[model samples]
Target: MIRKIIHIDMDAFYASVEQLDFPELKGKPIAVGGGGDRGVVAAASYEARKFGVRSAMSGVLARKNCPELIFVKPRFQRYKEISQQIRTIFYEYTDYVEPLSLDEAFLDVTQNKMGNPSATLIAEEIRNKIWNQTQLTASAGISINKFLAKIASDFNKPNGQKTIKPAEILPFLESLEIKKFFGIGKKTADKMYHLGIFTGSDLKSKSQDFLEKHFGRSGLDYYHIVRGIHNSPVRPNRTIKSIGTERTFEENLSSEIFILEKLEYIVEDLSFRLKKQNVAGKTITLKIKYSDFVQQTRSHTVPYYLSDKELLLDIARNLLFQSKLKESVRLIGVSVSNLNSDQKKKPIAVQLRFDF
Candidate 1:
């Protein structure tokens, strides 16, 4: 079946949002993050791209590259709001929306709510509507499958659209560089270079068994992509990231009450988030920072992710007790990771009980 998938990536999402919110920053290069020595850039506007300032770079390094660099603190709450706003636009087209980040998502519109059979038309219309409503530009890629669609979108960036038809898939893929293929990161690209697999053609020359022997499970995925035979669906079920919360005390606390209050709030938030994501975790972690500039984390992993709030809280709180902090704690945090959405279906539910 020829799946109609579209990949939409916003233009420098956080920085663009910052620029949109503040008119003065319009047309000027701006990075949305702190400008301190130890701070990092969370996002950079297109204008900042001229100076090579990018997201995840050291803030101090960015300023050195561009002396007039404008550094705005990250507003995560605002970004989350915008993400939901953009998400609504996707749901209108299709339910198979896979959000990659706050800025990018993959949509399966092969059979859409709009009854639109043309993925190209849907992508163009969505881009236009997004520009009209948010004044933000997005680039889109339309293709018969997820991997190709994702690559097509990046071909035309920042208010652009590109399409890869099923008929042209093999030749198009064969002509493309190995680095452009999905799942081949920098390290993988280097490894591929060492193996003389520089392009899709080179990848296709190898048999599936040979590819699998060299690359393991991922080699199978690469082999399929090379043959223009990718069949991964645009799953609507999204996996939530880590759950964590932190609190800064008014004054350093020696007593357990202050820590417990913060832990309670953290557990509540994580529990609510876990339920919403339809996932649970088996590991519980307690994060503590002492007044004397010291931080530590104690973690416990279990057989399964716990779906209950009280259970997570109990585990996290007990881990805190196990730590021997040399000084009073100034900050407290709790988190749960190692999630599995299939916990409900797995035998025994993988109940993980931590020993205090």
Candidate 2:
């Protein structure tokens, strides 16, 4: 039987909430983030987006794009509260819900609580309920699997929804831009363009062997996705195996001081997240990716769980020095695993954002 999957994405979640709560901010260009020179934009209102302002862009750059852009500090607590309200509406339909982030999730409605049979109606109802309860709009995409549903949701965004019936999958995918396909980042897309694969149809022309030869294992994924085939299930009650953050610098860093500075930020973010979740782990893993794209990970397991920021930084520092760097470092990451059972079962999404 065909599965029914729906991807729900709150429209400009943080920015939208700001608008809804403060009518003065509505229809204006605004960004949710620190307004400092070193701070980054967490979210940008649609008005700000027109001027090329985007999330993760530096606040200074965002301001240059739209001098009128209003920067507001993030209110994670309020956002979390609203996220719960939205999740409650999702549960009214199905237990098989997978939250990708506080602002987006995937719901499996093939066998739902309402037994509605129609994923379209379920998405519609859920969006309606979210708007009614929170005065915020959401975009939804419905299809046979997670990938297509996620892509579809972005098609007509902001209070819009779309469904890709099984028969329509091929043509729909064939017309999509290669860059828009999930898992294909800007770097990958540039490579695809150079290979003359600009769209789904272009990608579909390559054989499995050809794709695998070019993209390694991920080539197989591209081959199937371009043909509208994704079998990954909507996993519910999914345990977060690990929580981590990583950054790829524009210029490779050879200086130890610079590397340690970056590690400090990564450790701070991880520590705050662990505290928010009220969880800790005994294992600390440090990952480094070189300028040549060679990746390596080193892990240390302590006797007791640790969540202290300073302690994590110390461990990361030791791991960094103990390992020999083959080349200049391009990216670095820190993760904690072997979490407590309570944290593993905790129903919350931990989002990892990486800029290419």
Off by over 4 Å in 1: 241-298, 301-356
Candidate 2's residue-wise lDDT over 241-308, tens digit each? 67887888879999999998788777866775665455688899999999999999999999998888
- Model 1 over residues 4-47: C-alpha lDDT tens digits? 88999998888888888999999898988668865557678888
Candidate 1: count the clashes.
3
Predictions: Cα RMSD each: 11.4, 5.6
TM-score of each: 0.70, 0.85
Off by over 4 Å in 2: 260-282, 292-294, 300-326, 340-356
| Best-fitting candidate, scored by TM-score | 2
Output the number of the lDDT-best candidate. 2
lDDT of each: 0.79, 0.86
